[model samples]
Target chain A: MSDPYVKVRDLVTHYGTRQILNGVSVDVERGEIMVIMGGSGSGKSTLLRHMLGLERPTSGSIEILGREITTMSELDLYELSKKIGVAFQGGALFSSMTVGDNVMLPLQEHTKLPIDTMRIMMRMKLEVVDLAGFEGLMPSELSGGMVKRAAFARAVAMDPPLLFCDEPSAGLDPVVSRALDELILRLRDAMDMSIVVVTHELDSAFYIADRITVLDKGDILAIGTVEEVKNDSSERIQSLLNRKLREEEPDPDAYLARLTGTKL
Target chain B: MAADHETAGPARLVESLGRGTVRAVESFGYAASIFGETVKWILLGRRRGQAVRSGPIVSEMMDVGIEAIPIVTLLTFTIGVMLSIQGLDLLRPFGAEQQVGIGVALGVTREFAPLITGILVAGRSGSALAARIGFMTISEEVAALRVMGINPVRFLVAPALLAMLIMLPSLTVWADLVALIGGGLYISADLGMTMSAYVDQVLTTLEVDDVMHGIAKSAIFAVVITVIGVVEGSTVEGGAEGVGRATTSSVVKAISAIVLTDMFFVFAATR
Candidate 1:
């Protein structure tokens, strides 16, 4: 079998004295949509940062496309970063720039392509995110969904083989979230890119994840395909899934009342 | 709760002191690291035969130069009039009202213009630079730039340093001109000196060295303000309060550095 595109082994990270990721190990194959799902403060974001080479793991090793990122020089990292793209949770579009400028940033920095070609490529990327004509608009002018899409466009501008997104559906309506998930799947299949999404949303994770890595208290609880994770019968995963299911079920007040033998 | 708090007081105090010391050490380390990085980039840029890329430079020029022109001009004019008025008052006592022309011209061109402009820019633009970059650091935008393959110093500091290097001299020259004109008006009209006599006296008193001194001082002051602002801003921590503290400290440090450096320049020039 071919080696995984990204391999993280015994990764540990800390914020000062507080340990965040204890020893996370995961492998993501090429072209797969891997979801890192955990509750709040579960080190999911830290792991994502480690994977994207934003934060150095305190002890473990991260190899992206077989290069050890933790020890690489800054220039080498920069060169490697050109083949990878990231979409932050807040849609970190440069507030001072227009959507077009934001999308064209990587291309402008790394390529000497003619302006016309850059613009055409930028337009194509924007079109891929269903934002074909909103190129001139500033980030402040765009809606939350549009900002996410614009950020997505910028992430894919380099046509990187690996894409990392932190909380893709955060702060969006369910419909919009679903649309984003669909877009993620489309990008994966169409662009032939491997994607890693860090999220707490169960529905979003289940909807788009080809593989899921569940985290709890700085430890990986499970890492497997959707079916395997769902059917594993681990108490923590079951409880998490149950809690989500319980929250979604309608009107438990009547059931509680009947169980308690209380009269209205 | 009071009993428990009393029992924990010494331990808590020790812990707090320890944390504070650690933080101070960490901040010093960060500052050293940034200084080293700046030097490395300077070397790299020199080797590459290109100026370092800087976002802060463009933004600083827009904020400092374009936005500050009116206030700087106004202050220069006001200072000129005030200096002439004072010089006239003093000279009147000596029955030498005409000397006000020479006094105002010498003071404005050699000292007041550059000093006042430096202080103004240091207080206004320096604090703003500190606050903006500090907030950005807290927001992790600096880290974002790093991940995107752009050096923060190259992207943030180069522009600010370049802008101040260019703008401060320009501002000093403008301030010198405005101050002279305002002083000329005060001396000729208010103090009853003849326009041609005031003009000639001022012209005779003004030397090229006086202009050069002011511009040179302003340039040095600009470097001080930009360096302090960028350094403090880049070192900010703890979020909004940290940014606020950095801004305040940057202004204070820039002002102090400017004054001390100006005094050195004055001492050297006089010597």
Candidate 2:
């Protein structure tokens, strides 16, 4: 009923001359978990990067928390970023820092709190991510799952109102992935935070997503509740759900141009 | 048609040369931008709620300066001894071996000390900086900082730049003293000159301007090395092998830049 927390309208992007996202759009409501699902090269990650203002779109607009971000200045972006948390796919924790310091970085940068207070808050965030006692170790000492958990703790260090997770459960065991999904659910329900997750894991998506948006080749195939997306009669959706490869209708001219290294 | 065909090969070669010039200019522009942002952050980041952390700067000083002291001492000492030996050999025919003090003092203070220290730091600290930042770029740590509204230049480059600015000149002064001592030992021991006499020759031959010249050049070399390393590291692509390539490029570029800057300083000082 109210305005969505994030509104991306007709976003188009390009990597050099090749189009990555072509007029793709989606919306995320407050206190909702929106899972963006696609196979590799579906432009999902590019979409996430654009929403975070890491990359500017070739055209269209992105509104986050009712503010336009595409043309915002550095100072304005800093203000906006304080309320937005991002968890990169590879953890991206500062390797030079201990896990505790990494978790406390956002607070240290943005808050004027004392060192002891920051450390206490850092421990609390770590506890939430199930990494309470591992703060003294460096990120290299952590396992794959623990690294991901530490990265999550850092992202939510300031209790941001909106969280953007590139892929929370990617490359983890089923148990860890399921636990991450539960964590996502708890963050949304308990903290009242809106979340946008870009993932291709079907089980994780269905388990945590309030709504799912399916992308295929830079276009959205469907956007609806989990049940609504499942009941859709689109062949591409069916193939994606069944884990089957859909045969694409080939363009002979384009295929020939690609092979000959000349445009016709 | 004949004329066009005759000129085509030369024209293509010229076109590529022009493109390369443009690319080089663009690369310098990018480096200038990084340098400018680093200065701005160091000066104004605190007013904007982002303070450049001092812990990293102190740590960098240790890595780039304190850790480098022993090697700088050893190499400059050897250079001084070689200069003394060569000076004495040339002056011996004239029965003026004692004049070796003038040669060693003038040579070490005016040129060799700063040049040797610059090259050493380029190879040691510059390469390490390039590799460290290269890996961080590939791992998306730099991007993560940006996503958190933290300026990467402020968080990463400011510390190294400040450390180099403070350390390189200090190392040059240290190198000057060590090399002079080394050459003085030879003058006193083999040439039958008293230690105080050798010291007096060095002091009389050297001017404040000569010592200041080397220190000033060392400071310039420090900026060039730090900027080159940061630029090379941040632009690295392709992953681990890319990091290795960037580190090599950083050292090569830094060494070349240092030599060119030293030459310019010499030209200016003579004028």
Candidate 3:
């Protein structure tokens, strides 16, 4: 009944002269896990960045919690950003800070909570991510999986209603990846949060996603429930699901032009 | 073909000239933007209910200013002794070796003390700040800060700028005192002149304006170094190599900017 937590309409983005996202639109409902699946250069990450207002789109509008962010000023965007959390692919934890401090950073910045309360909350969040009692360690000391978990804890430190994760399972072992997927499910159920995950891992997407939006070359090829996406008749979708490469008709003229740096 | 070459030569020259001018303007604008944001956060971010934590600022002060005292003292002392020797050597030919006291006082207070401190801080803290921030930028920590609704400029650059502003003038004062003592001791030891006589000469030659001028230059130099370091760090590209390049550029730009600012100040004062 309520409006979607995020509404991205006909978003177009370009980097220099090249287009990244072309008229791509996506919606994420409240208390839903919407997985955005795409291969590299499919512009899934670009869309996520735009949703976070980290970059401006060439055209189209993004409304987060009913606020259009396309033209929002920096100060107003800061206000809007308070309700959202982003877990970057590389676990972007502040290297200078301890795990506990990193987790508590949002609380420290955005709230007037007492120091003791903040520390307790930080521990609880870390505990949720199965990183309890590892608060004193620097991010550099953590394993890759642990770093991603710590980053997740930091993102949800404020218990934001909306969360965006860029490639949460990337570069992790299968077991670690599965555990992270379970953690995402638990967080969503516990917090009643809306999560938008941009990932290319098919298993993780199928397992954790309430719905999947498959992107191909800056266009949405399919968006539906897991079964619907799996049964979709599009050859590209089937190819993605089967991990088969797309066969392209050769363009010898273009190939030669590229090799020779000349126009045909 | 000759006519085409003639036209292309002039066109290429004009294009490069325009590009260079554009780059220079963009760099100036970027530096000014950083400075403006830093000042805004330092002066106004707190009043608007944003807490400006003093802990980081104090820690930065210790790192940039207090921790630097030993090296600053050592180098400035050497410069002072050198000034004494050189001044005496030049004045001895005119049978005016006593004038070495005036030369040492004026030179140390007006130039050497602040200049040396500026260069040292630029090389030490500037490089570190740039590399630290650049690495953070490359690692996406800067973007993380943005997503958390914390202004990176407010959180990182403001404290650094504040630390530099407060500590640089203080360090210059320290440099001035130590340099004067070093020159005074050298003169007393070399000429068998009483320290009190050398002190009198320095006192007569030095004025409030000279000391103030050096302190002013140090403050400006502090701004230049902090701005360059923070700007380079924030705008880093590529990855680790980009961070390294940014650190190098920060130091080189800071030192160059400091010297140019000093020259401008001297020109303004003389005029």
Best by lDDT: 3
The ten-residue window of minimal lDDT in model 2 chain B covers B186-195
Q: Single out the weakest 10-residue window by summed lDDT for candidate 3 chain A.
A: A74-83
Better of 1 and 2 by DockQ: 2
DockQ, 0 to 1 scale, candidate 1: 0.34
**Among all candidates shown, the one with the greatest TM-score:** 3
Instruction: Report how far residue B95 has shifted in candidate 3, in Å.
Output: 0.9
Per-residue CA lDDT of model 1 for B1-271, tens digit only, reads: 9999997999899999999999867855765566566656666854533347555566778788878889999999999999988998888888988678888988998899999999999999899889878977886667666666666786677677678888998999999989998888877898666778877887888889989999999988877887778889988989899999999999988898888999999999999
Give one digit per residue, the lDDT tens place, for model 2 in A39-83: 999999999989988899999899999999999998898789989
lDDT per residue for candidate 2 within B121-187, as digits (tens), equals 9999999999999999999899899889888899899999999999999999999999999998987
Write model 1 residue lDDT over A1-264, tens digit each, in one string: 678889999999999999999989999999999999999888999998888788877899999988999999877887788888888887878777899998998888778799999999999999999999999999989999989999899889989999999899999999999999999999999999999999999999999999999998899999999998889788888877666532345667878888899975
Ranking by TM-score: 3, 2, 1
Comparing 1 and 3 by DockQ, which wins? Answer: 3
Tens-digit lDDT string for candidate 3 (B186-234): 9999899999999999998899999999999999999999999998898
Candidate 2, clashing residue pairs? none
TM-score of 1: 0.86
lDDT of 1 at B198: 76
